[model samples]
Target: MSKISVLIVTYNYGRFLAECIDSVMAQDCGEELEILVVDDGSTDDTPKVVANFPQVNYIRQEHRGVSAARNTALKRATGDYLAFLDADDYWKPEKLRLQMAYLKEHPECKIVFTAYENFLESSVSAQEEWVKRCCQFAEHDIACLPTALFHRSILNQCGLFSEDLERGEDSEWTYQIWLQKIPRAYMEEKLYLRRLHGKNLTGSGAKQCKEQRKQFQKDIVHKSIRAVRRNNMEKNGISVLIPAWNAQKFIVECIESVKKQKFTELPVEIIVVDDGSEDDTAELAKQAGAVVCKAEHRGAAASRNTAITMAQYSWLFFLDADDRLTEGAFEALYAPIQKDGSLSAVFSYARDFYDLPGRSTNAGEEGKVRTYSGCLPGCSLIRKEVFRKVGPFDLQLKTGETVAWQLKFRNTGLPSCRIEYVTLERRIHENNTGRRMRGQEQMDYARILREHLRQKKKGE
Candidate 1:
């Protein structure tokens, strides 16, 4: 048996398969290495390309999914270590050599993954920091499949990949391996290059890709639900807390959105804290069947604290009265908590819909907006225990109050994860709170910045 088996699963990728195969062949390792290429019934010249590489052991199978092709390759692989490389991705010549040396040094690690740079056409750039922001990673997390190298023994223990999952199969497999107490090591080197082109599966259809990502997240949630059921853990209920001031125009829509969540198995309580709205906000929330907690003309910070104090569930989700939750938002928020009991909070993306000029563009691809650092208030779910330890939102501040609390939570060193799957639609109109209290907002923001600077100076 060879010491390393390089598995490449391809389907109609004739354009880039040769470069991938050549990278493996160029590895300078002295140990014997075998290349296993599984073709998923490609009608293109992919077979001819593989045939030209005389040393590559190639097999043609029916058009199964990537997971099936990878499993087929695993069955034929006869090596102590197995590494997956996509046909469109290639690794550096020293990738295998350096990873093998690291594995040799750390015998306890069952899986090892390295950082990778992304390429568009011929120009290479680091992977988007927003991607890392959405998903929490160690300093050296594997950015792509080509950077990952794992011992064959991990496969034996964690089982094969889920053939049903067309997207996020690798993430599911890795999460399962971690659940089995298999230690993983990260190499801080960019050892691979992942090509980004229109022909790639994820890049082909933007809407379809987004839907598939949501489906992948649903699978993750389902896995967590199963774990919670089997272990009989403390199945925490979720409190949908909405802090409203003068949101009479949109409070009903917000309450209705929460009531329409996909995951209704867990008990959900809607707590609407009204901060002395002169409008009909309190009446709207009460008529919509929410528990309305009336406060005497306080700001959003005070209203949020009031809702938290009245919350009965251990898990709390703050939803603005003018915002609406996407379908399955609660399920996606609670999934990580069910899977990993150690997590303190889970956040998702919040999209702003404003009629104002220059605000119409979607900020998703524009990288992390400095305006909303930490977690977006309207789209986050947090464990009640975290608030118990870190305390409540800063009622002293008139604006950016939620962000102030998020920063405090971050300072507490806890496991936090963000998924881009769930989204909250934030409606921005003329009567928005920020618009009404612009001066107060600026003042509060300046105060927060000054406090941050003071803290940094003290630490130094």
Candidate 2:
């Protein structure tokens, strides 16, 4: 049997806490229920009222705001499902019963919300447009967390409530749910009661309160827009290709970084091409849940070409086996692509780290941040079609294949951009091919540039 954890967060609403507890205690839903009351430094008789309900669990925290209070209870909650209710609000006896029934009927829905009506404590002047506009008693349906019952999996994927937001935290979380494309259903029947006393933040007639609310709503909208764009890029999907040659020690960590990306609808496909490694790079990559491909004793360029042929998505990200992606790398890179359709690729800065001798950790302490406008594939996300236009890496150059390929990429006259966000960690060590072959790298660069100029003059 599934259980529901009812979370009630209160500030100074002592007088109404008993009513909220009574409503939860009267729930007729068959599921086991656990009620948690998080008191956000209430100065009133809130603790005394909560003491009346011996079964209710009470937690006290210093005044950290509503989001913090809810998060406090969220950490302690043990139920499979979660429901939020304000201390100033009460629900109908059939509220949980009906919502649970809807969930039982629709197995696909991860969340279900019902309509609610607001009631004011005292009448206000008709001339006060702000109060009239803020407080409405009409029954309406909304994506409110307090009126919704959702599975615990939603938080695992969409993340927790933002502690920075004092108000509209519910709306912000709802936006995350939308970004994750979580299946949800709405019940039209008004089953929740919102008590809007003059002290209520949304119902207050104070000018300062009104201004803060307006600003918070605007910030929420901008955040929602960014999240929507990131979600769209996720829907398009990405194939992360890693070309490894004798990279057994670093392959697992590299693959783990891609797996840690917080994608919702579509998961990133990690393809690791083992370029005939003498070590166990192929076996380790396969163990890390990557699609491992074995190729003959060829260079990283040929391995990358092999992976490109196996790629299933239009978008591609090439990651070096020795390097890793930062936490927000995908969002930073792909959000721009979603916003600008003309962009063929997006690149960013990479934080450099030195590999110390005798240290097992391949990723040493980070040193300086450097931008890669040249050969580093770990710093960019490029469309698969761009390869078709620019052509693949030259097989002749072993030391500077990516540098040579980048010159070809520039010659196509395709649009690409560089963002300031640091999305990669480039490891600098003794074994680095570019660092070891400085003379050869310069020669390769000179040759690629000469060819690029010739092609440019031909086009003219």
Candidate 3:
């Protein structure tokens, strides 16, 4: 048996998986270690991402929740000592080395865990300081799963995770073991890192926390959805298409926001087209419960063309990796298209959340930010058949490709609507490509409009 077997239960943590694995593998004290990753029916490119790591023992199963996934990993683990890590969290190099030493020294101690740090991902408020916060002495007196290392004998005594819960499985399992009166040790040094972002199970109130209440009045827009089974939703479906390239920083919040949309009556599926990101974009997108497709490093328009083929639903809505949809984004768009077969598409007003950026807290006051209305491609939801007529985006044009496609839609003279409800959010960061292409946007958009008018005259 190996000295320690690390059980990592992952649903869709593509972007963080490699770092988590590397953290354990770097344990220099050198006891034999086996790392097992259990992927619970991830629809993203997890299989491909895991293949990049040959050292890990990877097992995949159907779309069970994290509880079942943990139970699956527990059964396959072979080491005498066991440690559990969430895929989105990782350990410091000495984490395994220190915990193992503690377990070895205290024969009476059945479990040992170290203090940890929290790596907060996205912060909206400007006043919030994001320096890494480590779990201090006695901070986590009760053990967190990510920091805990236990003997295999403890498993024989307490049993595996309860497979019933969708959220608090780890807590429930640890609470059960805590009742057994098993001797456990806690180290003061921070040896693990928990990455907290808006997508976390407790996605409420991260924005309005005490960090900002002292400085400025807070406006929070928090909306979330439970990942219920698809069978429970309506037969009419809405598919979200996101084009990603080097979007590891923003994709999680983007996908999580989509999951929380207010259209509970319609089935929603997110499709992320990885536009040849050299970074962890594809893996991260998949881990965030998006279906991922790989494509060559083309421009944004071409990536959308690739996503068109992979979409499973009847209606398609395009989203940029850095942008997000609000809770009721689909409310105005879906029914109009469903009721009027002739309507080619329905578009919504977009709030450009510039001040707070992508991870905005107060949805109500977000309107104070700059908002854009009329024919924004990212805010529009289109019928799939409309694409067959408009054809794929112009390959020759590097920018303003969406404007060119919009021109084609105008050429068809089909019915469409502009709704007053704020359906989507356009995030403005330093890297926003549109911010750099202002002059080109005007020129290309004018050219496309002229071309459409010429086509209209020719048809008449």
Candidate 4:
């Protein structure tokens, strides 16, 4: 039989404590039940009342707020499933039966919630009328914490309730369930009772509480949309594009860095475009387990564009042949996009590293590293759709093709974010494209700026 832990958190509600405990004890479901009544330092006759129920486990703690109380109970719970009930409210006798049946039927659902009815404390006879009014306002359609039954393992994955927010802690916790896309189901039956009274937490300031609740709901919905978008975009995993031109010396290390990400489960494919290298760059890349695509004597811009055409995923990461990704680089750059889907790309800082004077290239690799904060392409995790929106890199620019691409991306008014942490280690040495073609890069920068100005003027 499945075991269920029922948590009842109460604060200064001695009169209603018996009724709440009785309702839980009245559960007809033939499953092992562990009922815990956590008294949040109530001065009332809460202890005396709880003592009357010999089967219930009573624990008291200093009043640290509701979220803290809930977290405390969570730590002590030992069951396969968890269910919560408010001290001021009670559940229907069939609530657990129906919810457990639903879980049994739908094995994929990790959590389930039921509809609830709200009634006033003073007028017990006015419940039917109140239910009707709540229906008209669609207030009885929600699934709150009291009506929720979820697997205990969810806490291990999603984490405990936030203690910082004064209100909307339940909403905040529920938002995480939605963001993670956990399989959930909702029953239509109103199986939970919400006792509305003067002392109700949401009744302190009627107008302000309503506005705050609305704002909280709005934020949850907005965040859920962004999370769903991120999940969809992540379905195909990431395509790491590396454009190499005579970079045989550093190609293996670059490819190895991509392969050894902290999140090794993330589906990643490395595509190295050998841009007409005279050395064994293509052979080395293929030996390093990257899918090598040989191309004519095109610049990095053309090679990148060619790689884009060959890419099979929705997300893209550009890695220069001579650069290396830092520890946990993928997780750091991908987190911002997961939080906010409106971002076109996420960038991390890169550190420029160079060999010491008279150091042998073939010897043990030692270099001096310095922080470089520019939003370079090598440190960016971009969505494939961004390429469609901003178009391909400019083939005309020899050294600053990425500069022109960055300008075009900015012109589209799409948002992007940067993580201050360094995710890329860029090697600064001879044959560095930007260092070798300084004069051409300067002219390209000026041309890119002029083009941007012309476009801005035309739009105005």
Among all candidates shown, the one with the greatest lDDT: 4
After TM-score superposition, the amount by which residue 54's alpha carbon in candidate 3 deviates from its true location, in angstroms, is: 34
Q: Give the winner by lDDT: 3 or 4.
A: 4
lDDT of 2 by residue, 93-158 (tens): 998988888777656678887667766655433344544555431221126578999888888877
Residue 66 lDDT (model 2): 90
Model 4 regions more than 4 Å off: 123-142, 201-208, 214-460
Lowest-lDDT window of 10 residues in candidate 2?
133-142
For model 3 the TM-score comes to 0.46
Sort every candidate by TM-score, greatest first: 1, 2, 4, 3
Tens digits of per-residue lDDT for model 4, 288-374: 998776666768897888677556566888889998887788898878877896887887787777643664232123345456654
* lDDT computed for candidate 4: 0.78
Query: Where is model 3 poorest over a 10-residue stretch in terms of lDDT?
Result: 219-228
The TM-scores, one per candidate, come to 0.50, 0.49, 0.46, 0.48
Please identify model 1 stretches exceeding 4 Å from their true place: 122-145, 201-203, 221-460
For TM-score, candidate 2 versus 3, the one ahead is 2
> RMSD per prediction, one decimal?
20.3, 20.5, 21.0, 19.2
Write the residue-wise lDDT of candidate 3 on 5-54 in tens digits: 89988876787788778877788757888889999988776777778889
* Model 1, span 1-460: residue lDDT tens: 2389999999998989999999999998666898999999998999889989999999999999899999999999998998999998898999888888767755766667766775664443335663333233222222344577888888767788889887777767765654464656555466888776555323334344455557655885467446544643233688888988888888998899888877865899888878878999988998998877656666788678767655656688898888787778887777887899888888887766653556553423333332232266657888865764677778789888887777677777889998867467666677777898899989988887787778667767
lDDT (0 to 1) per candidate: 0.74, 0.77, 0.70, 0.78
Candidate ranking (lDDT, best to worst): 4, 2, 1, 3
> What are the runs in model 2 whose C-alpha is more than 4 Å off?
122-132, 136-142, 201-209, 233-460
